[model samples]
Target: MLDAMIDDDHTAVRASTQDGTYPRPQLLRSAWTDLCGTWSFAYDDADEGIASGWSSAGVSERDIVVPFPPESSASGVGDTGMHRVVWYSRDLTTADLAGAGHAAGRRLLLNFGAVDYRCDVWVDGQLAGSHEGGHTPFALDITGSAREGARIVVRAEDDPLDISQPRGKQDWREHPHAIWYHRTTGIWQPVWLESVPAVHITALRWTADPRAGIVTADIELSVRPTTGTEATISLSFDGRELAAVSAVATDRETTVVIPIAELRNGQSYEELLWSPENPRLLDAEVRVGDDVVYSYLGIRTAHVARGRFWLNDRPYYVRSVLNQGYWPESHLAAPSAEALRDEAELIRSLGFNATRVHQKFEDPRFLLAADQLGLLVWGEAPGTYTFTPTAIERTTREWLEVVRRDMSHPSIVTWVPLNESWGVQHIAADPRMQHFARSLVSLTKALDPTRPVVSNDGWEQVDTDVVAIHDYEWRPDVVRQRYATDADIRRLIDSVGPAGRALILSGDVSEAPVMLTEFGGISFDTSAADGAWGYSSATSPDDFAERFEGLMAAVHASEALAGFCYTQLADTLQETNGLVTDERTPKIPVDRIRAAIVGHHAN
Candidate 1:
């Protein structure tokens, strides 16, 4: 929100919707203000600004765009250099709080989409609220603090070298290298104010079933559901009510599944098949007493059975791409919600039905776009390379936050707690790491038993529903030579033979649905640079196309592989291996890439 120009090294273009529109599109209200544009910012190198009364004394004379962290070029302060602490202060004028139904008399909820690492908020020099975890959203009720003109100050701190914190794709160096990009230091998401009733709905979750035509919506009321209050939910399509139900209770949480089957029988809705080919969504509205929320649910049934992935109770192929969720300008943040929507639709247009969202708890708006676009997603956490008590604590707390926020989305079919052998690397020999891996799986299951949980993806997959592997065998025959039969796929490849020693690091068994979860990182860019390149670099575009086709053909011919996820959707930072370039331009012909992936030639 830095005025007409944001400080960055790019084209110096402007972004749209820099404001108080609701970030949580899944649960939306019309009354809110966008406080995203500009604010007073200063770098706190000594990290002593808090004790120095920066909150009351006011920030430095520099203007910065809120939510676009200082490290990002789009933030208008492209200082990739580490700043242990940064301060942001905004003057909350009466005009900024003039959203409908949220004027003077209402309790103003100050919402932040995200703030990296640890953050403390102050309203007029008084402690308002604070939140831990970089990816999760938080809100504070600022009723009395909403004067005509008040100073709202936020201080955030992040240390990438501190392995305990979940930094995700944000780099740890002056310049991004390899898989990591520039570190997102402070506020990297939207900040806004909303007016809500004293007793309102706090959270809403939807558990949908496409096969049975039933949607169970769970409502968490801000206060205890009083006897005089009622919670009503309606499922509608094109404004025609398909099913309606209401509940009167006294509990804080109430759950009820509304059957939207045909009037004759309580079975599936044949016309409402939700797939990448035909994305269909059921519009849902919920009202708790006087508080109303507009939301929608995707009713696609996703599960795993018989060593196969099932969609809507039928065997389905997971044509997925590995998406790192980084952009050239915003780093971890998307330029706009429209950019997220366009990215989802673009991936779908390229013929990918699913995506393995790599190493990031992606923006909820992107997931909502996937829910609408019918793209299956494998939700994965950003990998942590070190194992310690601090790491485990942070992982547990933040992982649950991730699950609780996204568990209701029907598009998320699988939850990957860890990637490869990242944090728990010595799992094969380290008992503690093995136990922790198993515990992560158990913790994920305890929260939401609906989706399959992959504890440690790639090699050391201990206690997971999917036996996933990350093998980059360049040749087609070499790939076939490795995984040829069900025995080869199911064999406990650990603590035994050469193949076992090579492939398996810790898992006790591999008797699960086999998915070549990661492979085909063929880099087509021969540009001379110092970027972090891919596994196998391609010489020419024609050679890259041929190699891709041959490798995909090998994967398709293998009956043992339940599914495969291409290395990436687009190039990022130092890595230049993708079906499309970093700018989303197809490296190979889009149709040709699709043909290779689907095992068919384009017409």
Candidate 2:
């Protein structure tokens, strides 16, 4: 384990590195020794000028855990209710970087899993770099500025009022009652240091086209020198080497394409397609001189055509639940990789083929698990209340980051920009908002021509490819009345039509390919016994079972209905109306839900 320094009062940072290793575990590689662990933390109120200084008094204030935000109880700082600016400082020595045969390089990369809103980083009192956006990961190269043993200080400011930045579900208020929750400030995810050469691979974009039987690898180098550098890319499926190409890296961009057929040696030539049922992945290795980077990707294609969503050209049903990716212990962060995998497996066991990651962007590990486990995903930005020009620009930037990072995963099929008119007031009526929504959809479509883009889900019907709605009326009879007769269903569908709107519903529906995007308000034993539908009351176990049966019966009986996702897989904080408990423990037993969803036994 790597030795770390925190405030004198706090214990040494618990190094998550496995057996003093470096380079750390990426998405596909699952191991216990991966860099995931405890770090020292201190909160600073911007009103007070403690974050800018590095005095002994600033270091002795208090300590919390790293990766996990202060609001979460798991971080040992249970809900301070402080949404103001805060700073975190820690120390790492050269000895910490040296492990086994690995030596500290000239360039030291300080990596942050994620930070909320905006952040500025410093090493040895010198400014390292700064980054914006709350959900995505960013890093800074602190090679020249640091000493043999250096102090790393990070200051982060988050004004949830700043609607320009993408903040998924973080409300500025002290307490969050409805669909929103408390703001998660500074260092919510993991922070670590790595040694990398000055000239190394900064980023790589991997795209696999199974239909064309070709995989295109785009490599981005850190520096473009006068003399070009060559990268040797080795492509392999399973364990056998397919193709090896050494390509010259230009200042702009470099691409290398390899045919799948060339790798198949007398084997049956079947196109490798990634889907909820079958998620096949290929291993890839990129070597720049002696430094090597290993990664994996799945080959799949997704599109919407003729009012049907297709994967690999086959009509695929996206039976999905709205996953906000929040935990009672970690707030917006997942406690562990195991926790992420558990959610994916639970969703699959419940007969859900996909998940709508509502309003929030998820960690890379979550998407990696989904891709490996064969779960389709609908990704979206966090909901906001403002849509100013500045807001649109910032949102567009963050949305692009979301797309760039998650594009390689085959599980992600739909790119959803707006949700339920949270940002667009009167989304249905405001022509400007509607036009902006249409433009966003067009932008997403232009970015990734393969996937379907849903512009404004469940509210304004813009020029998007899919027409989605979120109707959560309580009464079952009323729900049935809206979609019972063809004329009624047609009228409901016609309400949002110029034409070509693939009607997708959140509640009960009687139309073909109708999605129950939201339903099932059954709570667990811990929920309060109120008549309200949210986290307040726990329906009687018998009543809960009855309602589940009734909903399944209604959905299966309607031939027009394609698929439905339960309200949620697990209960989020204050949202007790979930199929599973807050801790991801089953509320009504998994076998029962599986029987209802997969068996299709109508009551």
Could you give candidate 1's per-residue lDDT for residues 1-603 as a string of tens digits?
223222244322111112213487667765677888889999888878978899776697598987787877778887888778889998887777775346544577898888988999999888899998888888898887887678999989887677677766666666778777778877888888878876677788888765555788888877786677888888766445688998884678888778876522535464665666666766767888778776777666777778877777777888888998887777788877787887898788777788998888888888878877778899998766688998888888889888988987778899998886778777878989888888888888887877888877777667778878887778888777666777766553533432243344444444457888888898877445477488888888999988888888888877777788989888887788878877788887888877777763111
Best by lDDT: 1
Best by the TM-score measure = 1
Q: Model 2 off-target regions past 4 Å?
A: 1-40, 50-52, 55-58, 99-106, 225-228, 262-271, 475-489, 496-514, 522-525, 529-538, 599-603
- Residue pairs in candidate 2 whose N, alpha carbon or C atoms collide under 3 angstroms: 67-189, 511-560, 512-560, 528-536
Tell me the tens digit of each residue's lDDT in model 2 across 1-603.
233212244522211111212222222111112233554555565446343475222354566777778788877777647556776766665455552123455456677778887888877777888998887788788777545547777778887567656776777567775666767877776666655556766676777776667888877666663355777776655455666778766663568887777424334434455677767666676765444565667777777654456777777666678787888788887787677778888888887788888778887777777877888888888866787887777788888887877777778888888876667766655677777777777788776777877766664546555545555544445555655544655676756531233343232233233344565555554555233236324358767777666665555555344445567666666666777777777667778877777645221
lDDT of 1: 0.77
Model 1 per-residue lDDT at 131? 92
- List the RMSD of every prediction in angstroms: 6.0, 6.8
